[model samples]
Target: MRVARTLTAGLLAAGALFTVSGAAVADAPAGTKGQNGDPTEAGTSFRTATAVKQDQKATADGTTGDYLYWQFPAGAGQRPTAKATVKLPEASARHGAATWQLDVFDGLRRRQACAEGEQTKRVSQQDATVTLSCTLRAVRPYAERWSNDPLPGAYYIRLTVADGPDQDMGLPVHAEVEATAEDAGGKYAEGGELGAPLHAGAVSEPEDGWNGSWWSDRWLWTVGGAVLGALAAIGGYTLTRRPRRA
Candidate 1:
């Protein structure tokens, strides 16, 4: 009886461990940003925008009236949230309070509407920093229609110092941008890829239209769950079994 109890406890512990490990794996981000760059001539012109990824930080510097641009991929049926945080140096007479605006644009450079709050903020000498965040609902490509609707593709985030001290012009102010997206039920391929000319890494070519690593991870978790289930059943049986006659 003591041996059975010990075995049961060991099995239960192993099952718990497997469960925790699987959860950790599932919580891991689907992709990572491996490269960063700054925009050229910013503003509404997305042709010179930098490429970035979700949760990946990119830095740029600009002054009042100057705009910075960055782009990230958005898959179909996946909601994406983009955020930009600006940090200004110790405020001086030359650089005082300022209001910043963040705008989201599609591949065509057309502004996309936000599904949540406004993407603008006012930072002052006391604050010295400000962050702008915007969330967009799942975007779908227009089919059999002529609409200027936003589609799933390279999405641009444009940041501009809308109002600030004129003396602060040409002085560098730091800005960090990040983007994240919700899972899309495995509809799109995993591991994001950049558009072109921006080297993040050697983009993986799809094999039979599915990511092998993603499927492998799924298979591993499934096997682990099955093993854990079997161990649980064995442990329960051992705990409930009758003892042999003396």
Candidate 2:
């Protein structure tokens, strides 16, 4: 009965937290100005996730839910290889088995681009109460099957929740996917040919992201919650165990 009560309290608290967070995300208006005193996305990106090929669904339980995230590179097709790291939210309800995959695609302008690099994980059943979340990051690498082969243009990355059902929780995540593949050779491929002069248009800075104080507070709260939950679980288990009568 004691254990049940503790668990119930923890769950209720977590649910309340999630509700509050969702409301904040949905109802919060545009953030104020940054250090530069200009309105920005503020810890969010202009780029929104879309299913170029298929939808990637996700779910997060307390401590063992699976996480899903993906990324793509700028010269994705120009390089012979590619790689990405997917960061999972803390208190992920996923456990046990996990996996990642890479998909290639072609995009607008008949330009050569690599498709999104994908990552996935499948956790087995666990009894431990997941009080807090953890970052579950998966780093996977890929090399073009064909040498000197150019990838398709407009690459995209998507993650899918593949296993472990948790109370119908949308895979809560704070993920960022950016190009990490450096040009293998000083030379670049253009018009499907090698040894072409690199054009300035081929390289340009990505969109400016929002950076402000409010988002920092949100992240700090998330971190603090995870830490407190872990500690509570450890202490609760130690103290609440049945005393073995002699």
The C-alpha TM-scores of every prediction are: 0.56, 0.31
Please give, for residues 1-246, the per-residue lDDT of candidate 1 as tens digits: 999999999999999999999876554322323344332222323545666656567776666567787777765445678898877766664457777899887766668888875698887766777889888865442222366544556688889878877877676677888878764443333344333311212122222111112443455567999999999999999999999998
- When summed lDDT is taken over every stretch of 10 residues in candidate 2, the lowest stretch is 205-214
lDDT for 150 in candidate 1 is 43
Clashes of each: 0, 20
Q: What TM-score quantifies how close candidate 2 is to the native fold?
A: 0.31
CA deviation > 4 Å runs, candidate 1: 1-45, 93-95, 141-144, 184-246
The best candidate in terms of TM-score: 1
Query: What would you estimate as the lDDT of candidate 2?
Result: 0.33
The lDDT, on a scale of 0 to 1, for candidate 1 is 0.64
**Candidate 1 global Cα RMSD:** 25.2
